[model samples]
Target chain A: MGIIDKVRKVSETVWEIPVTYKEGMRAPARIIATEKLVREITAVMDFQSAASRQWMWA
Target chain B: MDVGVGGVISPGGIGFDINCGMRLVITNLTSDDVRPYLKEIVDLLFQRVPAGVGSHGFLKISRQEFREVVEQGARWCVEHDYGWEEDLELTEESGCISGADAAKISERAIDRGYNQIGTLGGGNHYLEVQVARPEDVRDKELAAKFGITIPNQIVVMFHCGSRGFGHQVATDYLQIFLKVMESKYGIKVLDRELACAPFESPEGRDYFAAMKCGLNMSFANRQVILHRIREVFSEVFGRSAEDLGMRMIYDVAHNTAKLEKHTVDGKEKRLLVHRKGATRAFGPGQEEVAAPYRDIGQPVIIGGSMETGSYLLVGTSSGDQTFFSTAHGSGRTMSRTKARKLWHGKQLQRDLEARGIYIRSTSWAGLAEEAGAAYKDIDEVIEATELAGISKPVVRFTPIGNVKG
Candidate 1:
């Protein structure tokens, strides 16, 4: 699945990424944040190339 | 809470100054009585009380006598007529904690503590004049119980510590603990600032004793300052301290370690309680609380930055969960260097004067370090603690004047 498809919606302000989706994962990734806050938070991250690489792998 | 030998030094454990603390005193005078000479009174205090970094008090003593002051705490001050015997009852640990061995304290610590007995050191150390809130005045039952009655009754609140003495003690032990950490005890540390040994170890015992000496030294220092304050009031107003009703409310230490029994996991256990940047907020009926304040619980004095409002809170039973602890003051929001860089001392003083808050300080840089804007909203922090069931607010006090060190 694509990176976006792998992200599971948990609540209005929360999201979860399953550990099984990654090979070296130790625990599920949990993010507690509003959509706007998440967008602002992600804007500071270097995620474009990583997301493209993940999509290519899928 | 357990610091097995070789733990890293965490700032949260020892804090900036090892035993920085606060003391609250309630007076019977009404606001109107003090209002007329508020400026003069603050001026007199600034003149009579030694302040700023490395300030020395009027009294001088031999190293042996100074060691006795550290060993006996406020009791030594009381014996020397700096304060009354009744004041001891209101202080935590009755003003003196056992195990203050002069031998455990270093010569450098002794030298630093000698002349600083009644001095108010720099940084956040301050003396303030405050009036109880109207709501507290209306609650006659509670007011009567806490000795706070009559609207606009003046109270004195100050925060200080053992000065250079406490710093040296913490410094000396931090080095000693660091040396023993790798060689004697193979313990890894996450932070060097949190350096500590096991509670039962010899090194731990020595540090604890020295720490108690620092605690005692602070109490005695404040006790002496209280006497000087009384003398200043008498000189300015032509009335004795008793005539002015300058009675001590309570004195509590913020940074120190003590062996306390608390219920953990549904079982009672003795734990070494280290309250760094925190105060004990024991609930009502706790034997540790003073007799008169037992029903109301221990008084928790939360001093705000000079420009903000301070608060008087009471401990609740819920505090048992956190070893009866609460935040000591409004936590700093900005670094001191940042505050000093952002604001000028003269401009800050002018702003405070505009709000009718009189201020006197020894150093302009010290004043900048304590700018109210440098701290978090005290009201919000107190609310958070109340919501978390650690303490309950009793009354809010807005500062009319302040003396900074």
Candidate 2:
């Protein structure tokens, strides 16, 4: 799934990926960004890979 | 953004040279005092202050003396009569940043810096004369409070930095940081150019120290140029610089890493602030600001490309949101090669002269790259900063005569 799909929408510009959603996350992923930024972030798979790597620790 | 150190250097961060920068000096002179002999004043300044690549100043000192320049910064120049003792008080970090170890500087770096002091080194560096707006004249009461309007009514501005020495230092560290990042830190890379060692690592510390030396070197270099500019003014106008009110208002560094305390959450935290192509916009009441300006905010000098207008801004409290930072220049829109292909130096010079903007430079290629068309509209950038609540504009300055390096 795309990273955006995994994130819980908080506001038009903000999103939250709860710590419990990841396996080994040290902290929840809170993105203070615009809709455009969210779209841009999800377009890159590398962020998903990195996010998954951090999830391993959770 | 979380990848940490993206592959391509952000022109916003790396700039031309990692630390290429500028300093601003507020003079006490009025426009009238400078008008009668503006041509002669510019000529004298051009002769005294070396321009172009590989340019050297009148001062010749030993390696040991040069080391002192790197370590002591503008203090070294003040001791040698290049600047006044009070001048240091107005400079960032009092014109000196600690941890500069001359021994760490490479031979080539030293060679490049040896004679370049006091020079207006080539590419983007320039000396400008400007006047405050008419509104400021009506608000003399307010202007006097901030030392904004001077007696002679003209502000002398210059943009330059450590020159070749700084470039070499950045080059040296980039190589070392790259090797250390891989061999010792186990950091797998993206772009080789974004090479870095951990902030607290040994290699990182070494680079920081060397960068301080670069910072100090530029301070001393500018300090010396200030003296030369004073001499030129005195000789051309037949009046001492002091009589012409050539007092320094303030000087600030554009590129450098600094350690500062700021509110991170609810409490204050100290963080290493790296401002590459950004200038610090410390708000009023901050202890770091000079006492005279403490109530009014730190002066933010934004130099435009030679063909455009420059601006004087003030740091707003809201800037704390962005780590007290703002954009440095117009930001280049074209590479040097592309600019040269599009514009001819002589034609550009003629065009500027027609517009009543005088320009003097050593290289045609340098002039072309600095064409106003080669950069973003400075007014728009400043406007964006204001809209973003990053900075507040105080006054706008249009250049009369320019000495390009």
TM-score of each: 0.85, 0.82
Q: Which candidate is the best by lDDT?
A: 1
For candidate 1, lDDT tens digit of each residue in B309-329? 888788899887568987788
DockQ of 2: 0.06
Instruction: List the global CA lDDT of all models.
Output: 0.78, 0.72
Prediction 1 global C-alpha lDDT: 0.78
Tell me the native contact fraction for each prediction.
Answer: 0.00, 0.00
lDDT of 2 by residue, B160-236 (tens): 88888888888888888776777888765445555666666667767778888888988898899898888887777
TM-score of 1: 0.85
Worst 10 residues of 1 chain B by lDDT: B3-12
Give the root-mean-square deviation of each candidate in angstroms.
8.0, 7.0
Docking class of 2: incorrect
